[model samples]
Target: MVVVKYLLKFLAVLLLFIEIDCDENDIESRVVDGQLVPIRRFPHVAFLRIVLPYGEENVCGGSIVNQFLLVTAAHCMDFVNLRRDSIWAYVGHENIDEINIIRSVKKKYIHEDYDPFLNTPISDIALLLLKEALPLHKTIQRILINIQFPSSKFVTEGYLAGWGLVDEVNETPTMWLRSITQELLDPRFCYRILNGRIPGTFCGGSKHANRPRPAMGDSGSGLISKHRELLGVMSVKSAKSPSVAFYTNVTSFYSWLVKTAQEALQSTCGHL
Candidate 1:
């Protein structure tokens, strides 16, 4: 009887460890139900590699705004240790392993007002200034940022591409780029679902059941409109529903982005 009791206790401890492991893995790779993107299709999509102090690496997606600037989520920069850590951007390749052009990040400009502790943080954007300017080519280019606000009458769908996890059950991120079409949701409906209003953010997701939705690792990936204009940055995914996610609206930060980019370029390149 005592032996059986001890065995049961051991099993319980083992099960607890397994649960913790699964949770960690889930948080690390959180993208699902996306289709593989064609090579050179998403030229402006950047695969960011952030190396922490102890050699630990974190991955986030970003959009190439110009030769020297790339934009991502401010939260993605929260844990970065600039004194010891490093960031690298890989562009012009659909496959993560294939390195066509690599640029090291020289500066980080996170939105000053961003607060991650908020129920829904606004201004979750950040810009990374590369040490060297990226060369434009057939498979490497910059995406145009949309300055006009999106409306239901004009914008119905947006495209999201990233190298995040394609299978949550297996806990693995795709080596190749993947993309999915998400239907934009009404702002009122999104506010209701989130239980609050996030002024500089908007919501989008798959209308059909079991369709792809942006997840954690996809944060900072661009939400591109049909006309190839960047509309949003992947921000937060709904905890209650996998089919719902929020994005930091690019249009809301257009002036800030442009002004910041101009200043940074002038300082780095001596001209804009």
Candidate 2:
């Protein structure tokens, strides 16, 4: 079996604009060092269709952790409220255009300390409670969240996946899933480069020749270590040109995550 040790517990995709303090306008995120992969490779990863008054758009990415839990970045939920009937989760497909399983979102539990504009954005994490548990099988499997500190090796080398477009402004979205390998850079180094605006996150990106950073639509994508363990969720691409990006570290907020999810399920999920 292909043991993919990626990061995170339950990941859910959010379809909100990941605005950055860049000179250019309309910037989101896409795969940088990317290669197309089969939809079945990462069966646990999920595609999201966000329906708002504007319209329906397949704009975010996530992973399946257990039966009814979905994890993702807090920024994804920044613009949208925790209304139960608005969000839907898709599985058993890589491309958003094809047929797949769709489920409704029950409730969203955002971290109490999530700050989108803080000096470093503390506790940039959120959880989604699903109406139904994920169906696990050969085509769909649940991955354990990275609740423990990763080894030095896994942190330095990891894989990230997304369906964001190459050109955020002009290009169309990709029809299939894409995966890339990147190095995990120190958050302190990234802070110095970002001038202290980045926080509660880790830095990672590929060494592509022409930058080729992640596209704009992959705001809630997952970043997993080489061992197939989830390390973080895509948060921001600190650089203006989009070479490297920031992700909300999963381990740092592991304790709060479990407690929030459990409490949410008992007292909150009944409403949905």
Candidate 3:
């Protein structure tokens, strides 16, 4: 009887994997337009599409930084097995043209504390170091990380961009840029939503149903303001209520970011 039970359980797990594979395969490919039409407005921004060794496609967003580093979410790392050939990180080009490839990742560093199970949002950030410096003069550059602590007393409005869905809930993701203004929700509110757990997480966005919000495949994308300062990384959404979404507060991770960037710079320019 135990042997039969184990067999049945194995089959169930296999079936679940199959379902998820199909769901990911169904992601719609829509050309980016609308708010994204003003490419000049966000010259430093870019998107990342992670392709698994098996050729499964999982889309996440990223930003260009300097000539070699790309910043995005750590959860995106879960999509591919580490043993697989190093995953590809396409930068600069949004359209499907092969000629626009910027540079490939020579190395990737995921936050050490990242938990695959909880998919912890607090540590849900990653950095990709390109093998070659991006052609900064000819190609656009990445927006610098927002280090200035915008006082919590002042509720600042921020913006996020991704190749995510267009509706309240969508299976197809638009290629055109979609953005919505979100007010920084207090950490207290975020803790309340999480039932007082993981206070490290911060919340944002309006409760208004009509307002556009981030959806699946939007993780690891850039959230910035008019100043072009990198703000937060789109992290979690209130599953019970999509109205409340959480982002990994970039300001909270400023020290780590600076340290990481400095180390990367030294290693890349070791000869200098």
Model 2 lowest lDDT segment of ten: 13-22
Model 1: per-residue lDDT, tens digit, 1-272? 99898668646533321221222232002458788876577888998989997668888999988777899998888768677899999998888788768999989988878976766758999999888777777787778775466577888989989988777667677788888888998888788878888889998995454777877578899999877788899988876667888889988887788767766665775532
Better of 1 and 3 by lDDT: 1
**lDDT tens digits, residues 1-272, model 2?**
12232312223211111111123322114674478887667766776666666564446777665556677777667666545327787777777678467777877778888766664556777887777656656666564565565877536766777777865557767767888776777666677667774445777774343655665767677787655677888877755435677788887877777677666555533443
**Candidate 1: pairs in clash:** none
Select the stronger candidate by TM-score from 1 and 3.
1
Expressed as tens digits, the lDDT of each residue in 1-272 for candidate 3 is 99898668646533321221212232001112225544445555566666666667777777765666777788877755545645555544434243266566666777777787884475887777767665553335567565454666554877776666655434766656566667777667677778765633567776654455777767777777767777777777786556567777666766666667667656766632
Query: Per-residue lDDT for 44 in model 2?
Result: 66
The local distance difference test score of model 1 is: 0.79
**Candidate 3 lDDT (Cα, 0 to 1):** 0.62
For every candidate, C-alpha RMSD to the true structure in Å: 19.1, 10.5, 16.0
Return the lDDT, model 1, position 132. Answer: 79
Assess the local accuracy of residue 79 in candidate 2 as a C-alpha lDDT between 0 and 100.
Answer: 64
Best by TM-score: 1
Highest lDDT among the candidates is held by which one? 1
Which of 2 and 3 is the better model by TM-score?
Answer: 2
